[model samples]
Target: MVRCSSLLVALCLVDTVTPWAPHAAQRWARHSARSANPQDVETARSADIVAVAESFGVDVNSRNKACCPFHDERTPSFTLNPDKGLYKCFGCGAGGDVIKLYRELANATFAEAVEALVKEDRPKTRRVAEVKEVDASERIQLKQANAVAQEVYAEALRHQTSGGARQYLRKRGINPKTAAAFGLGFARPGTARSLTKDMDKSAFVAAGVLYQDGRARFGSKVTFPIRDACGDTLGFGSRALKIRKDEAKYVNSPASAVFSKGSCLFGLDVAKDAIHATDEALLVEGYFDVLALHDAGCANAVGVLGVGVTPRQLETAARFSPSRRVVLALDADAAGDAAVRRLCDDVLPTLADESGVDVVVMRWPDGAKDAADFVAGRREQGETDAAIASAVRDLCAAATAWNDVDVCDIPINEADAASSSSSAPPDDPPPDDSQDELRKKIDELQKQLAELSAQVASS
Candidate 1:
């Protein structure tokens, strides 16, 4: 009977028609043809082959002994056949090719897994059949631009007279050591044109240091140089020193060949070691919040420029600590509540299900807007280091246990009188007051009679 019902349901589903059904059928035919050709499959497979074993921090060439993701096993049962780009776990019987491994690891569908692999495997540059060699003079010019920008930014910071840039760092809880380690600096007003005189002004304009209206805008703001893991400066993030209420607070370099906002966390390069050592990360919404956390001796903190959390950021955070546990400290507004809900519902579940990362939501105190504000308010009150640390830890603990169902289960906005009356259990006795009173009087005599009957029965 169950089988018959299932068949009926399937037939019903097939009978429901859509206008795009014909187009979907055509696309499926093309996809089938692509999958059927063994030669094409082999070429595409080889060209984009990914060794899941190696990708998961394992040595592909070594014996099949590594830490398993399925269970807590010290001995490696996960075997990688790099020759075929396939992996199997003998212990847990988990097996798959590259795409399957990603699906299993990320808890995503086949299409999502394919998309993840495509993003990971795409080459940085397009392939050229014949590569042109750069001459010595051309190489020297490229090197010169790189070297001069570093020196100019460094010099600008060292010369404290350069428009209160050093003072800004001091005010933001960034000590001298941290600032120098991150190569934090101010861009001199005329320096962009001077440094890139030989190069095109378009490059500086693209880097967000100068305006395209033929004016250098560095002197108008304090700049922080953003770098890659290799310590090469990719772009600049500028905070307006003084601005009208209508002006933007922070401006970043536009997307260029080098700097991709989606792939960069503001302070991850500096904070990576600390994050790995602690096995945790505190994700704040601003650069100063990260700085404050580090200064407060909680060094495992990093902030993304935007509110949107991307897959690349998650992957990068996971690379730092495979068991990534993040505490999100966003603002305390309607937007913040919505952001937290989205993270709990969508982002964290996907990460937890696939990558085994744990995520927690930290709520700021009422009227304390964001991380920076919280830290500043505590500092003003001369709060002890221990007190501050304990507060943050408590927030993290609360966030770790946050559940959407629990939040939505209780109606918070309704009146107490209405809610209490509505939720109270029904009375067991009938509504007739005379019957209820008569029953109560009768119950006393019945209890006495029952006691007497028990004695008589015993006799």
Candidate 2:
């Protein structure tokens, strides 16, 4: 819980939430009428007392008396345990952690308050701009539609405990609890052909979670819910269920009103706090990669949902990373290679001019396919979280950008090209670091083989 709290606080510490001040009294009466979970209520309070107090207007930071948020007071009587994230106010005897504060302030039930705290990274206002503004009513309707879709998918996964989705998660080192925490689901083939069979066709389609073409787009796959920075359920990313040649390995909800792949980074809603706290954003290649790395103790990791890192996504990352430092960790395969090249050749140049955060590429360890595989193998080797984190930090430290190696984009204009042709090298340019390293490895292998042959001849 402390780990979750600290991670959350980094992104959302001072972000304003809904203006509940006016309706706080009414909400409290309603919340008190409902039953609540005692454990959840306690856990939320324990995560970050300072954040909770500050959010509710408590001047917990003052050495002098500060006004109590719970009651009208000019001077503060709040005692705090900074290490423990707990607080007690001497005035009005109002004392508790953030959960208690929320329960009091929002007049929210224990569960609702805890859930909101858990979603602390979500921004208070995240209405994205488009060509035409989305009206308030349309936004509410889309939100409701996606909410139902997420419920449907999650329920399917829950029932499929003995199903392939469970097996895939186990193989990937994701437990059911972690899956639930991330809102993972199974687009079960065992269920109806289309998840939205009973859902509103128009609304679900508009939300990009459904299609009326009589085909289930994400059928029989593990669903990773994609949300905006404000925690609105936008759409989903799904990986193939049964490994097959014909089916594409991965798929995502198409571009719709709620979801725009180019503008969205998976896990932003959850990891924004950690990103802001660390002043660094970790960009990965896919949803599982983000989850796997986070589960491996790197809380700031996010993914592009199989898309290349776009300028809009980088800008979004920059918002969370005030220091403007980001590390792009892609897979060790060809697609990953191309993605990194494009990032360096395209996005890097544009980003460089901004004088904002610097971007670095995290090269995979030898033979490591992707981040998820790397972390899983590290765990298999009995590596501690500290060791894995250290390794990640070291890899990031060694990061060398394409620009650092003097890689530059050539102008396509006739005049620029004619002038630069003489200076530009041939198509077979000198090998980069990766190529040079491979050559060295091949030379070493050849030498070892020759040595083995000599020994055999003597024998």
Candidate 3:
């Protein structure tokens, strides 16, 4: 019995250290918890200890002593060692690596904390004049500033006076519960500048919440909180409730230390679990599309923050979707088609070669503008929930793989127009073809074919 117990203990230790142990899945929940991936764990552990501490607002002086966050203490007891990538507090007897420091300070699960650290957009070593690089300490402060701003915006939306924002959401078919779940908010005029009045102006400015001149980036817009998979509020994506003649209809917070348009995916915080569960990711272009798909029960949807999906965004998606399947459900307009063509011609091929992931593009329902519209149309036609899911699945199933999709094909709009014209009835009746007319038409076709063959042979 003693020998058997010792052997069991040894086996458990080995299992804990193994890379992606098979039992990891059974050990954690999909959404709230993460399976321990050894590579990710090592990456998180290797981060700078002092920098990680500083990210949580821990001030370490020359001696690396700070007040303990875990226990009440008047004197400094928490100590961080950068060289060893570890931290300890004598007062509370707490100790661990940088990952533990982050997990505690961020109030995150071990997996969530690791994900956050690994996914952090670490600034490059080389300095670029145009883009400001934020150190660990400053980055935390910026994130804190964003958190406060998001709260302010959310509170503004909940206010009785913010009916216009609520009305806009209603028009979009977004219920109150869904809006609240997504952290949708509003930034009233003058509220932006006022909200930063009591906060750190420089931090807010660096966070892209306030302009350098102290003006707010969003005003009278329905704000969407853009967060990472770990639920850290990075920035805001806002749509104007009432578009000003000179102002754009939509605006995103400017690139900052915590937020980059190319790297962030809208609704990722909410959709990552579904992506992991399905082992697939549904990529869309608009924020509304993400919301719509999630509401329709297709929760694996995420939206690109910019005009098109970037490699950084794809990399992040691939991390969650272990099966490495991505379905493109971008808009069905001419611009959307052009973007798809560009991806097929340039981006998807290279990504396929490197990652060996299967990517496909979805075919839109007739006359639908985007995913949101497509879902809305189905609902309007009285489709049941399961029926809608089936329809969506069918469309995905019918999509062609990226490599097989022909980029040389004309745009959807052009093809639609051509089809419409060819099938429509002619205004005048066709005249009978004479023998000479038939022969002449055949001869012209033969001449064109011969010319194409000659050019092909020459080339």
Candidate 4:
């Protein structure tokens, strides 16, 4: 029999049957006390505490000190008492049981904490079978709901043929094929309630498509279902089809059972094979940007629906190609620029540390807002496919050695230029020997000026 304490932790994490809000500590305790078997409680409890501490590289036996992740201290100030399955930090005055430790250290909610602990207890040999059973069932249910939602939204889009959604896509230059490839459909305002009338509204609510207050409340917004790599609709990201300068541009589904914004890559399902074939993935900001790239025949592209790239998404991308090379092509706006920087400083470094994946920023034309904007503007100017191809080739070439070169001067040697021309200008005419001393001073100043210029350019 499984130990009660360990079983409780495992059960908390694995069973999503309870609907209490994610981090309700009281609810978890009540549930654990009521449902957990007596024989398994102590052992389960000890195992969970040990596992969580071990995960943070804390020694289970040490009572005096353990690594403190909160501070930069080299010496350990945290103490763990394995006998009682508790921890206390001498330096920070932090004290907690296994659950509390998880909540603080992992930033996990009560439900998530429970689920994680339970998962850790699962035997390795049974893990695959258990996951398959759970995933298969959940996937089937999600696919069915998604299929229904997709059809309903598509039908609504047809009804609103002349509405703002159709116009919005057209304005963005998203063609029919490109739109369909992304399952781009419209949500009639207040239609979510009607569409999910016969279904379990809770499931829809959990998926972030429908709102609940005893009954469903579908807002007057056009919905875009965000799907996963396998084409299962995970959640909906909605936009106000009608033009309202005051309204928010888009509203995404809240955290739900099927959808995790962190784990889902917007176009990876459709772009997976292409990404794998090319051994590259283009990261973009929004859904439309991804569609635009695919429509333009650049199929090896995917986007994180939002700016933040999660560890799970990075791992998923790495699975496609061991040497994952992600080219970020975010927008030109301040938020977009910030996102790009975050991707470089935060997301990329973490991913590299975790998976050894390489990340590159795609150099967009200075004024272009995004990939869609880039493609649409190029098309409007009658730029031929050859021109677009050439631009992409240039970006890829630049990406290859972006790290090695001085960020200031991206060397652009004309392909047809003579080899000698690509090198430093032919030795400057020898300075007059009589004027050498004065000339040397002038040369030093010029070199200093050049160095300053390069530094300014890089910054």
* Clashes found in each candidate (C-alpha, N, C closer than 3 A): 2, 5, 0, 12
User: For candidate 1, lDDT tens digit of each residue in 120-154?
Assistant: 64222222443344343443343334445656767
Question: Best-fitting candidate, measured by lDDT?
Answer: 3
- Model 1: lDDT of residue 55: 60
Q: Evaluate model 1: give its lDDT.
A: 0.60
Instruction: Output the worst ten-in-a-row residue range by lDDT, candidate 4.
Output: 405-414
Q: Could you tell me the TM-score of candidate 1?
A: 0.59
Clashing pairs in 3: none
Q: Candidate 3, which segments miss by more than 4 Å at Cα?
A: 1-133, 410-459
TM-score of 3: 0.64
List per-prediction Cα lDDT, in the order shown. 0.60, 0.66, 0.73, 0.60
Q: Estimate each model's TM-score.
A: 0.59, 0.58, 0.64, 0.57
Cα-based RMSD of the predictions, in order?
Answer: 14.3, 21.9, 17.2, 20.7
Which lDDT tens digits does candidate 4 get at residues 1-459? 134344445445544433223323443444454343333433345555666777755554545456654332346777776668777665533555675576556654444444555556422231232322223355456656666777778767767453777777877777777777777777665566656667776556555556566332325455666766556677777666665776677787775446668767787778878877777777787887887777777887787787776655655554465366666666756566565544543344434533456767665673576788788778879987567656765675567321222222221222222353544454554346745665565566556656656766898
Question: After best superposition, candidate 1 residue 74: deviation in angstroms?
Answer: 34
